[model samples]
Structure formats: structure tokens, C-alpha cells
Target: MEKLNESMAWLAKQDGSLIVGHGPFVESSEPPADGTSFYVQDFALQDAKPWKTPSTVERTTIREMTMRFQNAASISCGWLPLDAAPFSVVFQEVMSSIHSGIFEKTVPVVTETGMADQPAGFAIMAAMTRQPLPLHSYGWIDGDSGFSGATPELLFALDGTCLETMALAGTARSDDREVFAVDEKEIREHEYVAQTLVSKLLDLGNIDRSAREILDLGSIVHFLTHIRLDLQSPRTPDELIRKLHPTPALGPLPRTAETLSLLFEWRNRLGCPKQFGAPFGLLDEGKFDAIVAIRGIWWEKNQVLLPAGCGVIEASRLVNEWRELRLKREAVKRFMLPL
Candidate 1:
């Protein structure tokens, strides 16, 4: 733990250099992008059309990138939206989508409190050390753009021909695990996520998923299902990512054209940046470990971005969701403030 803290401090102190460190592992990029190009191996570009299958740009291994970052002098941050979201407009859109039957279960998350003049790196380091999560805590700094947070969801982890993942949904602010585990609304929402992922895994291998259980993350509780897949043969990590992204936990069901249209419309209404999942990906070698970038602060220059999202179903209430978002944000906010 102490070594991890030391490594985080070393990465954080590197000004103008690109670095990403999670747990005992850290990766870095040289100097910085030419101030225009943002080099990210895990995430896609913002302008990527949702309908089109985006092409992947090959990236160097972490070992190579770390060497480059060490040799480079100055770091430059990448381009991301600095605009604030209009929550009211987004809330209305969620209601519209449910009424229009455009979505059965979709996540319409918003970024609140934009462009604050603060450096959240130390805060992130402190929070990560104090509250280590199973999904791992990651922080990245690119000349100008970067984000840090401990995720609760592991998109997928590959070991040889075996793969492990989870369906994490159904948020509750209660401390009592029993209450959260048995809530009907939460159970239904969790089932949507788990079932969706399980079906997709069938294309690659035989799979098994545990029944829903409570995942206690200090202040919050969620319904979680563990999934294990035994692939017929080894497959590339990228292939699995393409197959599993935008799950019902993150997007709407029936992954179709009509639903995607509604998803983007809601994003535009909420001013939700494409960077919601930014800085969220994995460490790939023989093993591929990745997490969903849900809770965290994305920072660049003097601007600080807090991104949060929630799933909306037919039973969702606007006011209740609004309050839920507040609670979600507060979970991270506690560690972000001065201790």
C-alpha cells in the first residue's frame, strides 16, 4: 500500500507528462500528444459515430509507453468538452424516452459542477489509498487531460482462455445490505444488465453467472452478479470489449438503431460529454483487466469535471433520480475534499 502511494505521488508530480497508474501498476506516454492528438488505447474518440463500427488505432505496450514518458520533457493534455450539462433538460428527455417507448432501460447520466479551478490529483491519491476498491483505483494525467476514480464494475478480466466479469447495477443509499439486495426495482434493473452480458458471452464460450448479491462500497450498495466464461479458445481482449460495451448498465436495451438515437438525444439534452467513460479501459498482457469509468473527476488546466450517471426505467421518478445522482456524486465528493 505504501509503495502504491509512492508510485501515485511520483506519477502525479510529473508535470506536462502523460501517466496512468492503477494499484501497483503504472503506464505513461511520452512528452505529451502534439497538443492536438490524444493518445488513448482503451477508449474511442468523441466524434465516433455510434452506428458505425469505429476502427482501432494500435497502441504500444505499457512498458514502451512508460519509457517514452520518462524520456519526454513536457506533457500536454488532450481535448475534451469543458461545457456544463443542463440537468433539467436531460431529466425531461429521460421522461420523454420512457413515455415514447424509445427505451426500456437506459442510462442518462449528466456531468455536474463544471470547470472548477482546483487540482484534484492529491485528493485522488488520498482517496484511492484510503478507499481501495476491487475494480482497482486509477488516475491519469496527460499534459492537460486526465481523470481518476475507483470503479465498482470490472467490464472483463481475461486469463488465458477464461474470462471473468460482473453485472453491477441497482444503486441504493442504504447501509443495510438486505434492503438493497431484495428491492424489486433494483433486482429487475440488475437482471437486465446480467442477462444482457450473459447472452453476449454465449457467442464466445460457455458461461456461468452467480445470483444477484449486495456489493457494499462503503457508503453505497449495489446489486452485483459474477460471471465466468470459458472460451473455446483464446481470443483477443479488444474483441471482447467490442462485444460487451454499452451494456444495459451503460446504455439502453435492444442495442438497435432506434434506441441509439434516443440515447444520443438524451446525451445532447444533458450536455453529457462523450468522455463519461474516458480514462476507463484496462491493462492488457496475457491478462486483460478493465473497469467501467463511472465515478471520478476528469481534470485539465483549471477545469474540473465530475461525471455521474444513473439508469432510468419505467419505474424511475425524476425527483428520486435527481436525489440519487446527488448521493452518487457525494460518495466521491467526500474523499475529494480536504481531509
Candidate 2:
């Protein structure tokens, strides 16, 4: 708490440039009366390391994983990400590959309603998901910095050595950003997070199924839940974060193996466009933090680049998903709206 508070205090004193598009802010005075325009910007770090390597999975291994632990989990996810993602130095290389572009895609969707907002990028890890505020971050350039992001995801983060987390949700600044819901199908979809996490926990030891879902914080409303485990037995917080990382907010839907696997290796990927190419951040430990590279625009002086995408589920309607993702492109629309 002290560490985070101190950081916030220091940020307020800076010029607040390190954060421009999608980072956190201590307190915002008031958005421009002309209203804010939305655009995606993929900012990369000056120098960085790699993300974690994924576990290699084969058909037999996958089946074994399902057979041994599927039924024993109290909070299992339906997603099964293959253990073959870039890990360690490999991921750092992935992050370092920012010059060519951060593999970013931003779409601009302008609707006739709402204040014209943009959620930037969408991440789906297994279950725990959030439409992260693109403007939530901490840093400094020269002697100035501050946070952005309307609905800041981390409601309470005590970064005193061990990181404790609390999230918030379900408020709309305007219709530019779309919120999430956990309907029956969504619960089923989010099972991916639960599944992945539970498997890792089971590997540690006994964790009674005593946890339940609860709201992390409140304003509008979002389906929230909490998972509890005393990893002190033989496991550690480091282990938990390692195995259960790529939180739903930054990856894919819950209950799946990976959120943005090969995120760069999908079909029809070029369908959308890149708003900004450097939306990247480095974490305390060499991993990449989720950046709102989605809802941004790249304009060195007058050139514009936009990134936007939609959630694709088996139940996802192609046209409807397209429309929804379009609505998310409001980050730039904020600039083009009044026109």
C-alpha cells in the first residue's frame, strides 16, 4: 500500500508524459469539454525482456491432463492452453520485437450513442477477465507521470513485496466501451480460467473448496469472484502467479488454456488494422504488462493508425461480434466524432 501510494504521489508531481494513451491516473480534473477522442497506441518499452515460455502439449498429454484433474477441481476452467508459449528469454524477444509493430490491431467503431469510448485491447486468459482501462500505468519521463484509464482494473493493489490484488468493474463512461457479463454461457466460457488455475493448485497440495465468488469492488456492476488458497504449504505466490498468470483480462476467455495464443498467428488477422504499433510495457520481473494497445491511434504529427478487434466465441455471431468490436474503436472516434 505504501509503495503504490508513494508511486501515485510521485506521479502527480511529474509532467505525466510517460503515460499518454492507456495508463492509470491518480485523479483526473475533467475531460476536455469538447469530449475526449479515442484512439489506439501500442507503446513499446525502450528496452525489455521476454514473456514466459508456454508448456508443450501433445494429444496424449492433453488427454492425460483432462483425465487426471478435470473432475477433481472445484474451480476448473474449460480452456486448455498448450504449454508452448514463449517463456523466459523467448518472451522477452517477443516484447523486443516492437519495431516492426507490436502485432497490434485497432478498429474504430463509431456508434450514434454513448460518449464515444474505446477499450483498446481485449485479453482473454481462462476465466478472470476485465476490459482493462487502457490508461492505467505507472512510470516517468523526465520528472513527470500519472495514470489514465476510466474504470481502473486494479481497485486495490498492495505492492509491498508480495502483491495483493483487488479488482473493480461494470461502469460505463459512455457507450464507446463495452462491458462484460457472466451469463450462463459466459460462465461456461470463463471456465477456462478456473480450469487452468485449479490444475496448477492441485499440483501443489490440498486446497479445500472453500472459496466463492464476490465482487472485488463496485460502481456499475460486474460478475466478480474470489479464489482462496494458502500457498505457504509447499507452493509459493511466485508459483501461483507463474502458473495462473496471463489473467483473463489480458488473454482469452476463462476455462481455456491460453488467452492470446499465437495471437499473431490467427486466420484473417489482417482483416483489421493497426492504430499504434508500440503498445507494450515491462513488468517488475521482465514480463509484459497488459497495454491498451487496442484503443489507440498513432499520429506522429498527422498520420493515424487504429487497432480494434472483437471477441470470437463459438456462440459469437460474426456480424454482431464485428459490430461490438466496431463500437470499441471509439478511442479514435473520440477525435472524429464531432466531425
Q: Pick the candidate with the highest lDDT.
A: 1
Judge candidate 1 at residue 320 and give its lDDT.
72
lDDT tens digits by residue: candidate 2, 1-339: 101121221100011222122223222222122322111122222222222111221112212322333333122112222122212223333333322344221111221212112221110100011112222432211112112222223311212222222221122224222334434433443354445445555654444442324332222223333334444444332343344434433333332323244433231233223212222232222212223223333221122233444333344334454444444444334422211
Model 1 steric clash pairs: 16-75, 75-143, 76-143, 76-144, 77-143, 77-144, 77-145
User: Any idea how many clashes model 1 has?
Assistant: 7
Q: Give the whole-model CA lDDT for all candidates, comma-separated.
A: 0.59, 0.28
TM-score of 1: 0.73
Would you give me the overall lDDT of model 1? 0.59
lDDT of 1 at 213: 80
Give stretches of model 1 more than 4 Å off: 1-85, 114-118, 337-339
* Candidate 2 structure, TM-score to reference: 0.38
